[model samples]
Target: MSVLLSACGDDGGKGNATNTPTTNNNNTTDDETSSGGSEGNTSTGGPGGTTTNPTSTTTPGDPTETTEGESTTDGSFITPPDGGGGAKECDQWTQDCPEGQKCMPYSGDGDNAWESLKCTPVMENAGQVGDPCTVEGSGVSGIDNCDKGNMCWDVTEGVGTCVALCVGSPDAPDCAQPMTSCLISNDGVLTLCLPSCDPLLQDCPGNNLCIPNPQNPDAFLCVLDASGEEGQEFDACEYINACDKGFTCANPEIAAECDPMAIGCCIAFCDMTEAGVCTGQNAECLAWYEMGQAPPGFENVGVCGIPQ
Candidate 1:
């Protein structure tokens, strides 16, 4: 019998424990297009091979796929609002921060991570989704060139690509891209529509990592790397996207190199069809899911772990 390891639990902002698997999060009515091969920011990751909105061009402990709908990070997880970033000012869905100002998610305490919501003046000629953007303060500062309904994402240095935010009620947030799923963060202050991906291909645009969705681990999505603080191999990991580009969080027991006391730790993913792909001693590429149980197009997905 296979031993049940602790779920890669405990976060830079980790994925949820739910294991709902699907080719698409919702039964997408449209046949979502297969992800593009360029792995470049120019291609739209939309459903039925359609580009809802085309954007401008654009990881890892060392990053390859780019951003997703509200999706961002390694391993996967959510960050609760600490209730410290800023006082509630306006509604993000309504874009009601006031004329000339827009509501955005940002770090009120000056911490590197986004912690709350605030109203900031919209830039003149703010960039739109699929456009190049710049951040005013920090990447999480929430001040950017993107207009309301969109935000700067996959930011490197102070420049990044603009991606759409989630619309509809928070309880049923939606994205224009049929293949993307909404991910909520900063205690629901920030909402994104991240692109879903095949874990085996890791085909996110421009350095985004592909891992199991925090919203649905059985499904994969493209996300940023550690919010700019990538985790190294064997580093204690909580968030699915916090790990370096080539690394993934594993149950500590499977990662022999991890500190014994850690909850989960960073490890590399390997191809099941290849041997000697794993970097750790006694580690091997073990099937990520039971034989024949993997989602279509991901039959070869594997993780570096000790044989049970």
Candidate 2:
């Protein structure tokens, strides 16, 4: 695991740059990806993703039939809300589209990562949340079998799981399922709610790392472990997910070992519950957030750092 949630405490972190969400910035839309893909294609830095979440879609086959080697879907089909058509722009959150059509986030500019929102037809027998689903075009194409409020995740060559969209508004987004954290990436184009996990256990499936959401350090999300160099403790890092597993980047002032010139550097996380056992030069297992601030199950979270 790269970070923790439930609240994960904090990174004492500052964004610089790194690929997130499957190393691609593909996490955003079930419709338009909401364009929450990976951070691989864009800007400076963020912890939101590159788990390649758009690793997100597939073209639909017969809704009621599964041929050999095909995955079966679960639950009743969900009908997407509608909006008018003809390339009319729409909002992913509001989902105000025409009958049978839904608002989806997609790469309208062709740069990928669901940079824009558009209207598309909902699949017949659209897959419900947590069901096996499919998508059309590319991951960010915003066309898929997932019902509104959900997207196909971890798509591999056009197959993936139907994951839920964040339930709340963008500024204070959250997940409906317990222990899930909302991940916002691609400059707010993507809004995904992913399961949270333990950093010590490194429990995330596949190659993903459990890291703090770059937008909200204490609330961690399962993001792609895009550590090209696999930075070690005290090694300079520019992004929250750059360090090796169990390590995260922090402000330089957090440790004397960190080079003063670097924007941030990798540091190990510690359990505040085991206070005396974790020590460092001018550093300690300090609470990652103000006491009583961490979400339940994360009260014990801490980081090895100098008291500021």
Candidate 3:
């Protein structure tokens, strides 16, 4: 009997729950993908792989100045509509702001005004390539967050910088600026900009490596190579790479009678062809492809598991 294993996939966004595994023969659809950092501004896969509407490119005004009935970081004066109650402040969700400002909604965390909308200054320059950005936070970094046509990639440790969105052909990629490489995510859903690098020679700057694109295997992107000790089986892990190379962060259902974690646990990789590769007495080596639709390059991958 063959066992199936379910794992997480990278969606260029915050990690979602692990997909449940199913039993079937060849052509089984495994919805599992790899896990990574927080979500980006891009849309999920649609019919014909079409992306949703891109972020707005409208520039915000000087973040320093404060407008009447608008919220700001600086200490300023602005009485509510009529001393206390007249016209409500702007509604970011409804885009209800004064003519000169944009509705910058509150993120509800870390010093942000929860459930409140503020009329922020509309600057002429926003969403430029290489500008610093944050997915969820007050714009205190001086750099305007993603405005339009740009997204904050690799959102980890509570920060994700800006990167221009790449559209069009995968073979003939067109990034916002020249010299930027169009890199695809592991789940083959998103394509964003990264500095070009040579994988064969491993000449990427710092600790980054040129890894093959999961969607388009022919293309490569500069990423951090797996290093350090591998996480042991059943250890808590944040993302796929958080576990040592050759191991995967998998759903706890893979283990017989084991409780699942909100994040996931590190599972040892196994070869289905060989018998008893999984060290767990109750665990079996299950082909990832047999469970569901494995990512493009993960069809042959297997994980230690117990039949679900």
Output the number of the TM-score-best candidate: 2
Q: Candidate 1: worst 10 consecutive residues by lDDT?
A: 47-56
TM-scores across all candidates?
A: 0.63, 0.66, 0.37
How does residue 147 of candidate 3 score in lDDT?
A: 51
lDDT of 1 at 280: 81
Assess each prediction's global lDDT (C-alpha) against the native.
Answer: 0.47, 0.47, 0.33
Residue 35 of model 1 has an lDDT of 12
Give the clash count for model 1. 45
Show how many residue pairs clash in every candidate, following the order shown: 45, 45, 21
In the range 73-140, model 3's lDDT, one tens digit per residue, is 11011000101111225532244566656443222222211223345554555545666545433222
lDDT of 1 by residue, 112-191 (tens): 43445678877889888779888775555668888877877655445667878888875566778678866554445656
- Cα-based lDDT at residue 260, candidate 3: 59
Q: How close is each model in CA RMSD to the real structure?
A: 12.7, 10.8, 15.6
User: What residue runs in model 3 are displaced by over 4 Å at the alpha carbon?
Assistant: 1-106, 111-147, 153-160, 164-231, 236-249, 256-263, 269-277, 291-296
Better candidate by TM-score, 2 or 3: 2
